[model samples]
Target: MSTTRSTRPPRTLVHPGPSPLSQRWRAGRVLPLVAGLVALVTACPLLFVALEATQSGWDSAERLLGRPLIVTLLWHTVSLAAVVGLATLVLGFGAAWLIERTDLPAKRTWTVLAAMPLAVPEFVHGYCWVSLFPTVQGFWGAALVMTSSLYPLVFLPVAAVLRRSDASTEEVARSLGHGRAAVLWRVTLPQARPALAGGALLVTLYLLGEYGAFAMLRYTTFATAIYTQFETAFDTASASLLALVLVALALLVLLLEGRTARRGGRVVREGSTARPGRPLPLGGWTRPALAAMAALVGTALGVPVYALGYWLVRGSSTTLPSASIWALTATTLGYALTAAAVATAAAVPVALYAWRRDTRLARALERTAYLTRALPGIAVALAVVFFAIRYAQPLYQQPPLLVVGYAVLFFPLALTAVRSSLAQVPHGVEDVARSLGTAPLSVLRRVTLPLILPGLGAAFAMVALTASTELTATLLLAPTGTDTLATQFWTYTTGLAWGAAAPYAAVMTALSVPAVLLLTRRTLGGTRIPREATR
Candidate 1:
């Protein structure tokens, strides 16, 4: 709406117009462009693998595809994904219900302990379990390791929804003479459908690209098979063939997840604080339940911590190649920091555009960011390799290309964090800035940026931690001699040199300690915010 002031010579009122193309151009473009470029580059390796696989004709594809080993690998991969998805869903839903619904003892403590599994990388956990019990080295071992590592993904999201979900509907159902079980199944679980599906999707995708745990546990899934084909057979074609198959599987999981998640509408927390649902009394099972929780925590957290410590102690006495270890650590940190900065910078506009613009284009771009997350690291690395060799041969083996791959692979972490943080800023603040005759850029710099800085930092740190531990892609695309901690740890662990692998794993876990602390602080701070502000 606009008004003309007749007494003031018909003063013109201005309406916000689309930003000019030139104004859209900023150093910010470098981030997404770099991200896009890395995505393309990572796409290359997979492309090469695919080309190699298909170029030999249908005969070769059929021969490779028909092998008993391939069939078993496919079975293992799918089974692991399915089982892990179910496991994570159960853990996520049950934990969320217990913590957010029931009168769980020390709810806050449980919350932190539950989510803390995410801090430990799957590979590290695998190493710990295998070290503790040599028998933990096969399909069952893989499932156990993955369940412990990935249940947190489901737990985090479902917990969030459960915490903020409206309880009135469930109460209403209860008032209608529905039994407790009926009310929960009919009302509560349905409300958590989207979050559960999303979490399951994440778990499935992770299982698809998994290498470390699979390798450590003697489970030869697609990821390990691809690596084996590449390394043992010296046949990138076979690996690419396998990778193509893996990509198809990932895509299928992703699509199914999307449908499941989209079935539920957005959950809204209405009115004032909703009472957390009462925890069902454990009755005589209290001690047993506590023991079960203890066992779960022990397998997931305790074994890993103890094993890493044991190996560190053992490795300390052994002759460690200090120069190599130090160099690898420095390289890992450097790449992580670079990727974090790039990812965080790239996530800003994508998030801001989604938050403020509300256009189809912005929405699509935000979704694109999520696409990379859903894709397996191997697929992304493969694509990057193909793109690099074809277009940027000079970048064929450069560290920059490697860093770019990291950013593309993990940008979603930054995007999600930034989006949540940006959502916290009230639109009224932006309106106030605009009313005060401030430009969009000024408002962004003065108002939005300051408010979201913590979020941006948190995003950067999260990405940094993830990038540092990324194994499969880093193994495939890292420069000829660059040894990341993940790759180093994998090499030693695979060689059955537990003592040597321990140092790298310990250092990696040790490096993540600060990040875990920061995340805990953030979690507590977010939870402690006024209930209204949380809304």
Candidate 2:
């Protein structure tokens, strides 16, 4: 509230409406409300799963879940995720250390190479391995492909933390008679626990919901089973029950991640007082270090390039009509760009709500959005179909429905990018602008948005790349007669036309490379990856 202040009007002040502060507070309340709505929208899949399970009755669920195949799938999913997460931790942390802490050669080139695996789509990684080596199938093959592709999720975060972290703690430990190895183990690793945990959560959650990659490797996980039930058997009840179990598994993992991160603790220091110590010189160990980096990049990146090249050279069916390929490319780009914009727009309110008010409500809203991360793409696709058919009949199987599905499935990616960008912005900047009598909207446009533009670009690129290569949800949610690059690749691969599939995969990799570079530069350079920011 405000009142006119003038010498003549002082005797009879004119009343004004809400002040900027009051208006901001009022608007702040609405953002969380919007955030809450977004969370509810995202939860549709989880709720749909639960609803279907409940409607199916407990006895039916028990009958379906007690099968040998269910147990087998459970073991496969859990074991593979455990192994991959562990491998990713070691590989990611090692690469980050080599680049940031040790005197390694060509650190800049190595950094880019280390992150290059992500430029190749996940399914492409699987296809590359199994195509080159037919024996690469089942447990070991799935683990290899997933580990190679997902390790970068861990690597980028841990690298950023190591790059920006203060090395004074290590110096103090060394001065106190600790050996170099001891200091690194005790001080450096501990300081990086948060980054490790953040990266691990992403890897683990992804492994849980992953479908196409596992399917390509002939691995039978819950995701594959769910997809089979929906597509082949048309058993919605069985699929939902299985998805409920998956949801339970996801929530359990979330709980464990929180406890593990909290237990590990965090090392915080004043920015001005922090400094990086000199890099440790690697003498005799340099050769082995170089070899390790070489082998990693080779397996993760080289095989895919080699396989694509081989298909082009050896396979007779590699050539295709240029118009068809370009048409599919346009369709993929259109949907991906739409999803990227929608997801980024949705992220702003949730990110802003949490950033402005670090309250339980804000945090809950934020986590609610992240909870969708654990869901399989097929489950999300099914849920959208369920709701659309019932309440939004017009949107069922329409392009808009596909766009919504993409937005829902990949919203977390956008949120991570946006939230991390928001973290770099100093608190009180927006308040200062508004306090100077600038309207809230004007302040956001001129002050806040400008500050987080890098994040917006990162968010758009990340979502676009991921969405473009998406297969599981796109297969289910995309409108009739529409084929993205991923779907086209899947179509040809299933028909044993490896050469035809290779071209699509190559195109996807080409499109994704720039986005991967932008994401790496923005995320690893300054922005923080998403974690338990509320805590």
Q: Root-mean-square deviation of each candidate, in angstroms?
A: 6.0, 4.1
Model 2 spans with C-alpha error above 4 angstroms: 1-15, 264-271, 318-323, 523-535
**Alpha carbon lDDT of each predicted model:** 0.74, 0.84
On residues 1-535, what C-alpha lDDT tens digit does candidate 2 reach at each position?
Answer: 9998666634657778779888787776777788888878877888888887788788988888899988898899899989999999999999999998999999888989999999998889888888889889999999999999999988887787777677877878888999977987888888778778878888988888888888889999988998999899988889888887777787787777777677553544324455768999999999999999999999899999999999877774634333377889999999999999999998898888888889998877777677787778988998999999999999997999999999999998898888887887888898788889887777778999999898898889989999999999998898898888999889887776788788889999999999989867754565444343311
Residue 445 displacement in candidate 2 (angstroms): 2.4
Model 2 lDDT, residue 526, Cα: 51
Top candidate by lDDT: 2
Candidate 1 C-alpha lDDT tens digits along 401-509: 8887898788777877788778767768877876676656777899989998988987998899899889888988899977899988887776677888887887788
Q: Identify the candidate with maximal TM-score.
A: 2
In Å, residue 108's CA in model 1 sits off its true spot by: 2.1
Q: What local lDDT does model 2 show for residue 207?
A: 86
At residue 201, what lDDT does model 1 achieve?
72
Q: What would the C-alpha RMSD of candidate 1 be, to one decimal place?
A: 6.0
Residue 228 CA error for candidate 2 (Å)? 0.9
